[model samples]
Target: GGSASSGQVSRGGGGSCAFGGMGGGGRGVYAPTHVRSPLSPQQVTAEIKRAQSVVEVLRVHKRFRSAFNYIHLSATWNVLGRLAARAPAWLQQHAASAGALREDTHRLLCELDAQGLSNVAHGMAKARVTSRDMWAASW
Candidate 1:
C-alpha cells in the first residue's frame, strides 16, 4: 500500500514511486528534431498551380485512380490549405478565382463516385472547396 504524501508503494522486496514522488516517471515533452520553414509566396502559388494541373489532367482522363494516388491528393490539398491560410493579402486576392480548384475537387468527387469509392468520396466531400480567400479566413 502507498500513502499519498509519501507517494510510494511497497510490494515484496521492491517499492515503486508514484507521480511527483522522489523519483519522477512521466512522459517526456514532445520536441521535433527538425523544424520546417514556412514556404515563400512563390512556392505556395507554385504548389497550388501544380495541384490544379494534376487535377486537370485527372479530370481529362476521367480517372483519378490511375493518374493520382488518393493519399497524395489528400496530402497536397492539406498542404495547399495550410499555405493558403498563411498567404499574404496580395496572394489572397490572386486566389479569388479558385474556381479551378473547386472544379477539380468536384471532378474528383465524380470520379470517386464512378469508381464506387463512395466511402472515400464522402470523406473527401467534408473538406471545403478551397479558395485562396477561404484558406486565409481559416487562419
Candidate 2:
C-alpha cells in the first residue's frame, strides 16, 4: 500500500475522471479514495448512495406514472417520433412507442369530456351520466 498516497484528490488528465483512468476504466495501483481492499469502505458507500438514488428515482416515477400532466407534458413524444425518423431502429421504436401510448391514452380518456382529470371527489348525487352506464373514477 506504500505505492498509494493520501491527500485531497484533484482533477487530473485532460480527458480523465478524478478517480478513474480515461473512459472510466476505474484502475490505478492507488485508489482515488482513501478506503482500501476488495470491499473498500469508500466503494461500499458509493454503491449504497447509487442504489438510494435509483430507488428515489423509481419512487418518483411510480407516483407520477398515472398523472396526465406528466404523460402529456408537451409535444415531447410527437417531437421525439419525428426526430427519430432517421435514428437507429431502437431509438425509432422508443419514439414510436411513446407516441402511440400517448395517443391511445388520449383517446381512451376522451370518454370523459374535460380538459383534464380533476383531483376532486363529487358526491354520488352529482354524478353526471354521459353514456349507457359509465362512471369515470375520481383521482
Candidate 3:
C-alpha cells in the first residue's frame, strides 16, 4: 500500500508507488485507486454522514453497520453540518470519559475534516472526518 490516487489527489501509505524500477528497468505497478473512481461530492457527503451516524449510534445503541445507518438516517438530514459541526465539543467533553465511543467520535471528525467539502475540491472533499479526540479519549 503505497499511495491511493483518484488522480486528482493521492495520499501515500507505505511502499514505493511503482511496482518496477523508477530507474526505468521494469514495468510499473499501477495503484488500485488509480483505476477506481474517486468518491463523488454526493458520495462524500453520504459517507461523512454515515460515519457520524455510526459514532452516535455506537455511543448509545452499541450496534454495528446496519444499526448505525438506521440511527444515522433517523438522526438528521444535513449530514455533514450535523456531523462535523457537532463533533468538536462532544469530542472534547465526552471523548475523555467514553472510551471506544469517544474514539469513534474522534475518528469521525478527523475523516470529515480531511475529506469534508465546502465547494472546494469541486465539493468532492465533503466526506467523513477522523478527529484527534481518539488520542485524548484513549488516554
Candidate 4:
C-alpha cells in the first residue's frame, strides 16, 4: 500500500482521485469543478451525429447507452454506418463495443418505427454488420 500524496484526495466510497494543488492562497482541498449535467436525448443524438471517429462514437455510446431512446439509438446506428464507411480499419479494433451496441439496438427493436428500422438496416449494411439476430429482427 502506498501513501496518499498531497495532491491526492479520497473522494469517499473508497476511491481516491488525483487533484491539482489549489493555488491563489486557497486551502489545498479538492473542489468539484465544472460538474456536468447529463446530456438530454436530443443532445446525445446530436453528439452521435457529430462524432468523426470510432473512438468518439464509442465513448458517447458507452456514456449514454442506457439513456438512449429510439431516436438516439437510431442516430447512433446511422453514425456508426458513417464511421464504418469513413474508417473501416479503425472501427475493427472496437468490435466488442460494436457487439454491445448491436445488443442494445436489438433489445430496442420493437420501439423503432419503419423508417428507423430502415435506417438501422441500411446502416448495418453499410457497416457490414451481418449479425443473424439483427437481420432476423428486422424482418
Best by lDDT: 4
lDDT by residue for model 2 (70-137), tens: 11322222232333333424223344433343343333232221222221112111222113222222
Q: Which sections of candidate 2 miss by over 4 Å?
A: 1-64, 69-74, 88-139
The predicted structure with the larger TM-score, 2 or 3, is 3
In order of lDDT, best first, we have 4, 1, 3, 2
How many residue pairs of model 4 clash at the backbone?
A: 0
Q: TM-scores, in order shown?
A: 0.28, 0.21, 0.25, 0.64
lDDT of each: 0.32, 0.29, 0.31, 0.61
Residue pairs of candidate 4 with colliding backbone atoms: none
Q: Count the clashes in each prediction.
A: 0, 0, 18, 0
Looking at model 2, residue 9 earns an lDDT score of 28
The residue pairs found clashing in candidate 1 are none
lDDT of model 2 at position 19: 28
Q: Which of candidates 1 and 4 is the stronger one according to lDDT?
A: 4
Residue 56, candidate 4: C-alpha displacement in angstroms: 1.2
Sequence-dependent TM-score of model 2: 0.21
Best by TM-score: 4
